[model samples]
Target: MDIKIIIDDKNIKTLTYDSPVLLSRVIRDSGCGFSFPCSGKGVCGKCRVRVTGCVSEADEREKKLTGENSAFRLACLTKATGDCELFLPDKNITALTDGLCSRYSHSPFGEGVGAAVDIGTTTVALYLYELENEKLLSVHSFANPQGIYGADVISRIEASLGEEKEKLRALISKGLEEGIAELCDKANINKEECKTAVVTGNAAMLSILLGEDVTGLSASPFTLADYFGKTVNINGMRTYIPRAISPFVGSDITCALISGSDIMKNEKLSLLVDIGTNGEMAIKKGDEIICCSCAAGPAFEGTGIRMGAPAREGAINRVWQERGKIKYSVIGDKAADGICGSALIDSLALFLSLKMTDETGLIKNPTVFEGQPAIEIADSGVYITQKDIRSAQLAKAAIRAGIDSLLNSCGAASEDLGRLILAGGFGSFISPENAEIIGLIPPGTAKRTVAVGNAAGMGASAILLSRQALEKSEITAKNAASLELATSDFFMKSYIDNMYFTKKD
Candidate 1:
């Protein structure tokens, strides 16, 4: 039977299943953005959907989760028996870096136009550069359709080994193709004129796109990955996938080095943290640059919380304490949909200040509530649950621990750094003060921290434009060293000690 899925106030599409299937499976196969924080274990009720046709009865868990009076069904627990229409409820996400970018000019040697792309696990940004004229033809950004498979590289790797690899490959290819077409149309340029695309992503994404076996990249001792390091045709365009340094440290970080070379000059103690699902960091001490990848997961990007989402319309991106009352700011100047990562970090800190969450990261409200662990926000069915706190704890611990590990690698401490660069969009949106309060960033380094928005994309554009930038990326990849954090005892100890809302006393 065919199930018609309709996003509220958006387009509609119909898909088929040969037999009865879990709604979560159907949704996963659809390549749409929906939260499965518990990996569809039904423990987290984030995947709430409204169905309007033949569907099986909601179980006890669903009733307890959404209440008997509510019409929403847990997509993870519900089963679709017949043709039904369902709508996924999430504020439309329109995310691109608002942080200042390093300067770039499209100066490719050839006359043809080129598309520079940075395919993040959760988002994708494309820069259409006019090579000869050194002009930016157009820019387009969108969610990575493969996000439906999972939110992190680990999950993506598991799915890629099975039949789902082709689905992921096709989704990303289609997104790239559509983005190119959209940029060309927006700039009134012919599609044929754009014959080249320079793409950079982590090993998982690159492996899937290049149709290479990802076992070496995903399995234990993950030190192997194929960078292709050559040009190949993908969706009618000659795409150049750059050389990667390791399974975890991808070409994206190599590009970031090119973008942040100003701060990365020799004889300087600097740290670059590209915060994302994968926390990729590079610490420069003199001539050598040590890089490490921490599996930070997607909690920082707002994918794992009960009401978590991207920084978009209605997402509460900031929070503050005002006259003994907490105040918050939502993106797009709209009603609060969910608290984004930056705000969530701020909220955690705020809660700690207000004695809502203790130093041990436990929520203790003065007046007891039915949901023992959740702090309800404005009674709009939005909340920061206990699970959300634990997710933040894990993610922050990974990132902070990774930073400590990197610093240890270079025989330097956080106080020795002259500068700290936080790349990627998430890094830019975050307030360093709030981040420090929550122990996600070093407290002493807040003053010198700089968030260069989407440095990976900026570097990709530079590589597309200038010969020097391209050659620099190559050298950076060749010279960079990757550290395995899981093998470090200090990282493990730091992770355990840093799992609280505040630093260990």
Candidate 2:
């Protein structure tokens, strides 16, 4: 018999018998936005769903994480035995494309002028805009070449610790150069034609690009050589970097702050959370702006998890409730391969809400499923384990605690925030409600939140397009104060306390 499944309030076509596919796979194939961070290994537990008519066997791990509930099953673990309905949580549905890219329409330079570049730790993006009409001429993105060394900033930091520092720097520079060349090629323009360019990145990444020693920025005392605006020539492209607010906090954040200029100028309080391998935040309260960067790790970038992958094709990106059943969506409609970072965030929130995992980050009865062969022991070793959770907890805690510290420093409450801006590539994949449910962002902030896709890149482009915006970058970097979250006693204490999912009442 064909099995009918409904996802995200829509009835998907019935599946042919003998498919023997997992519920998660079915919904994902059906275009339901569901994320599986661990890539259906059943370890990350983001693909949870409720089923009726028939119940599926629960792996020891699923039972342990979620408890033995008749109504609930890990979508990745449950198999479709007959026609059924599933409900996807609202928090799991992530809109494919919001109007985030539209904000960069204004050309910084006059007509046919300027370029902006955002050198992300994982990806690099570039934009060309017409200065006169303030319209985007072209936009280009590519995987950062630094990714070959490691996926996250810390890994790159570690890679830079030894004699390979120069190599790491060259690798990143080469990637940027290639990205620039590609963008120029796509736009049918020459690199020199771009009158100006603005670059934004974390402190370590910026230091490496400029061929500066980054080791000092990684350890205690965490001192930075300089944070003021400086002009540098990269392949004849004149670039401006925002001043470093602190050792961990870099100029890219300054660019991000520049993009959210409206928030700073407004009377209302706002918080800007740029979620990445290392979560950087800036909270604006009245006239005061408090900023900090937490070493949130690379869990969101597909590193450290067994089945983790970048936000590429075959990766699950969103999830939701539909007609009493769980549904999910994957990038590019590819086969389920692995989960990316945003999916990891969603999975953690869902797992916590469903009581599959406790605040302590412990999975009660972790066991492999029969058909899910990925969970089997391999020659190298076991794949996903308790250690992965510990890593994720460390990452989540740093972000959560950082938010708490920033709020406290500004002498404001979560309710005081008038606007919350989420900036990053990974931020695009996350559901605001799931982020709130995981305690990653403040509860009410979700409603106030808007995802600004690659704001750093947009800000960099803004500077590239307009001389006025370029001058503003300098002023913004100078006035912006950076808080070193790693060295501060408050951040340290908060980090330690937030290591677990359950916060004290």
TM-score each candidate: 0.92, 0.73
User: What is candidate 1's lDDT per residue for 198-310, written digit by digit as tens?
Assistant: 89888788888777788886667775556555678888887777778778888888888887445566367998898899899998888788999888888888877767878
**Candidate 2 structure, TM-score to reference:** 0.73
* Per-residue alpha-carbon lDDT of candidate 2 for residues 1-505, written as tens digits (9 for 90 to 100): 4556665666666666564567866664454334444446666555557776544678788875455664578887888776666666433212122223224333354335566777777666777766667656677766555543445676667767787677767766766666666666777888657666677788878887887777777678777776647778766666677666777667777777776445556578888888887888888876667788887877767666655667677766655545644445677856665667776666676666666567787755555533322221122122334566677788878898898888888777888888888887777668888878767776677888888777777666666655666666677666666676766788788777777776644
| Local error of candidate 1 at residue 26 (angstroms) | 4.0
Runs of candidate 2 with Cα error greater than 4 angstroms are 1-112, 369-386
Error of 1 at 462 (Å): 0.6
| C-alpha root-mean-square deviation, each candidate | 2.5, 13.0
Candidate 2 contains a number of clashing pairs equal to: 41
